[model samples]
Target: MTDLDYRLEDFLSQVELEICEYLNKQKTKFPNSSKLLKRFTKRKDDWIHVSNHFRELKAKEKLGCKENSKSKEKTKLQDNIIIRNNELAEVVNELCIAKLFVEDITIDSIEYEPIVFKGDKSIDFHLRFIDGQTAYCDVKTIHPDDTGNWEQYQRALKNKLFPSHASFDLQQDSLGGILWHHSFASRTKMLEHVIEFEEKIVQKAINSSRKIMLFCGDGFRLSKDELEDFADFYYTEKYRKDDFMQLMEAYSMEKEAIILLRNIDYIAYFERKPMNLEYKFIPRVHGSASI
Candidate 1:
């Protein structure tokens, strides 16, 4: 199977496990909780369908079929679109855990295509804090494979066309990769919206200023050279150096709030062996919490 196929399988397995755990907890709350139990039980059939579909896709991949060809691959890709949806669910879970919120929050709480400007669009989470204050949290997930793609994406952003990718689907399209290249622009727009949202949230924080917490995975930070490459790619002759400097300053100021919880760190926290990527850049903010 392709790497994408393997990732999809891993993601689905995790989702199934999470669903089972949720049902188990609910069962403990009410011994004869037929309502929730029955709902989950019904989902079992759907999960089976998903598994069978994946098995068929795997068989095709083994036979060396065209990755993005129509037929089983396309069908499988469409069927497995839920994988990305599940990833979004995971992001929401991580956000809640990191933010220490008791209430159930979800990706559905986020507004997509929030506003369309001349150059960009935005997606942001509207989170309600424990202290009755609402904060707009912008969550970003980066993969180890993002360095090169991110540079290309930053270029697409300048042209005002966002590249799209079918990361959730089985059929990998070059067009999608091209679209993925546009992510940098889209993300830049998202960040701009986040700044505005942060201002509003800060104003709403009754007792204190609103906090903008950027929960990033290991892929978020790169080596100094990689960062410089991305900066060079995104910045133009007029604003390249200045933009790069401003970004560094901003990063320095918000280093504390910008948590780089790497995958290895996560594995280590869970008592597993550290995986890879040894000499990475990990800057920690010291002193005050405010940026």
Candidate 2:
């Protein structure tokens, strides 16, 4: 075989190995490995092209070409794919933990993929918190770099129009309420999901006498504006003017109590260094908590 062909084969092998390693370490169960293998084999073709180019230059006695391409820029695409996959795996692990936590809190039927409103969408987990009350939980992964986008979502929630997503609909039903936990990462997309989730799902839960709690696993922070926005939004959307006034009166009469749980231990690893963490709680007007 030519040098280009040999090098192309080597690159394909490495890509396949890396993909398999990731799948195994993440403990993913694929319904059909053969199908996935074929899909990945097609993806490997892109890398093979790069490898072949490098090999061609080497055969031509180019000074810069070594076993791999000398240009660092060529690897950027591959590097990004690797980074994204790593982040996804970390997020999955955190979701597993959140799932376990939900199970611990309730003995009621713990259902995954619970059908809602005759659609393909389904809630991640639904728990019966108590007699005649159910808690719905949706797990989201956020990356810290996207805080600004999440801030926008918090604003949208106050306005009552949520950006569309399949999972959002499942939590919107008039029955059990929703609880959204940022499983891992703190990206804008995750924050957006939370905002839409609160407005579309959790608020519905609160309306039905169920409560909502937002769990930020670790290494994530929320600004004052974000918290205040959440509080104002929940109050306005969830309660009528008179009921809100009654709640304020009750808080004053009872000497308003705030339960703060700081730095609760949960499993998460920062994808970058020197990670800073923040958590804020916004109490809903009628004794519901938003964080």
Candidate 3:
């Protein structure tokens, strides 16, 4: 095998080992709970995905040269795995976003956790483009709490208002699963809820002043089959305008929020997958943009 290829495979193996060790330690610490073990088992691809991207960064020398397996702080994924699932996803989003730039010929190099101004404030990534231009990028994952969906879903669960046939373990099930199960309710209500949810997300998203904003979410995961269906539909002009408009309205930015978004150069969404990393950069619009 080529040396570069060997290095990539070696890096992936090292990351996998580190993850196994970490999760095993967690399992030992919480013997009564199999949640950590179960999570790592089921979501093992997530670490692999991050590791692949990280290897790409390392290969391109885009990591600013300080990061290595031994340095926990420099290794963003290692330091981030200590928190909750959403936090873990956020770190994954950052690495995946970095991978996108690393692969892009327009980008020259990348720096993680770059300090752009005074105080302790920092952006998640600093991208130096090939044309001598640079941009500060930050990753934000819209948590279920950001839209009050978690609380509402919990209330629905407590009141036994969720679908009768739905079978879910509260701690083990994802918020996306709950939403999908409850999606059989009134269409109008669902549309309104979606719009309100997007409004809340857009409001929260505007709080960042970085040159680039990358928004991702735990509930926003799409299966490979679903992505295939979307790809087919995307290539065809079969989508109805009214339906598209309704979707846009559901995810549309508020008029006041437009000003905040306009201040940023670009905004993108991380199209999360269980085993893949894909991104969709939203084009700049005059007054309306979808989340």
Candidate 4:
């Protein structure tokens, strides 16, 4: 599509297509990975509407059954599937947002993940802004697969994928986010992850001379009541408003939060300038929009 005719959905759809093709081609090597893509794409809408697999698993674990059955194994496998799919979803979401950033703040062309940076790491996107500033972008995700017997793959995930993906050495400036997608399995887990990240990661980025973005996960495709309920879960009982405030202090405006709709490959990025609480998702392309 021409630049004038291109939309966000088109970019996202292409990403989705690429992911599906990769999974399909690598099914023999990564059976669970390919199965996850197929399973989610087939019924993504239903999964989003009733996205409580984690809660259900917790409830089952609370039972503390000591039985060794195929059913139990199956349940555990499904849980792993949910985690992996959510993690992979973050990659597609990040790339789409990279395209958006290129269009928004950039003046020249941007390159995708390429191996020509510090530590020989592959920075996600490198672009030049309208004001002649360059940005080295990177997207990071933490998801360790559980069911896999592939020890090598797990090692690579921990060693190569996580540590080597940083965009530390900047040509001029930097732009990136530490994606907290599928890094945790529960609210308590999320709290722990957030604390560790804040203590170690957030401050360093804030102190950096370059711009950094933090994309926290908001994978819920909830109704109005559900969204409000979630807000209460965090702000009221969990005291997450303080965390939000701290995050604002660190990565405030250019301030972005992301959400995927109930169905389809579309993702919405909510942004606010100067980070003054006037946040909205800025009307991105929906599943039914013309591409």
Greater-TM-score candidate between 3 and 4: 3
Best by TM-score: 3
C-alpha local distance difference test of each model: 0.36, 0.37, 0.43, 0.36
Clashes of each: 7, 8, 0, 0
Error of 1 at 32 (Å): 20
Candidate 3 local lDDT, 1-291, one digit each (tens): 347445634643543464434434433222322333344344545645555655665565554555455345336753332233444455545545554655577766666664433453345666677787776665655433222245544554676543343333444245554453332222223233333333433544534333654455433432222222222223332322222122322233342242121344544445664323444543221221121
lDDT of 1 by residue, 1-291 (tens): 556556645654554455444434543222333433343345544555665666676677779875566365667665464654344433433322322322244211222222233443232334444456544444443322322364444443464332232112211244444334333333343244334444444344423423333333333232233233333322221213322233433344376464221111101000101121122222221212221
Query: Model 1 — which ten-residue stretch has the worst lDDT?
Result: 264-273
- Candidate 4 lDDT by residue in tens digits, 34-91: 3335434554443333335544544666688435664576577667656545544554
| Estimated TM-score for each candidate | 0.35, 0.35, 0.38, 0.34
Better of 2 and 4 by TM-score: 2
Scored against the true structure, residue 173 in model 1 reaches a CA lDDT of 40
The residue-by-residue lDDT of candidate 2 on 1-291, one tens digit each, is 466456545644554464444443332222223333443445555445554554554555466444444455446544644454334333333333333433353433444434343343334445564475765555443334322234433343565433232112223232212212221123233334544445445333444523333333333342222333333334444322222122332343246453222111111222211121122222231223442
Model 2 vs truth, CA RMSD: 16.0
Which RMSD does model 4 reach against the true structure? 19.3
Backbone clash total, candidate 4: 0
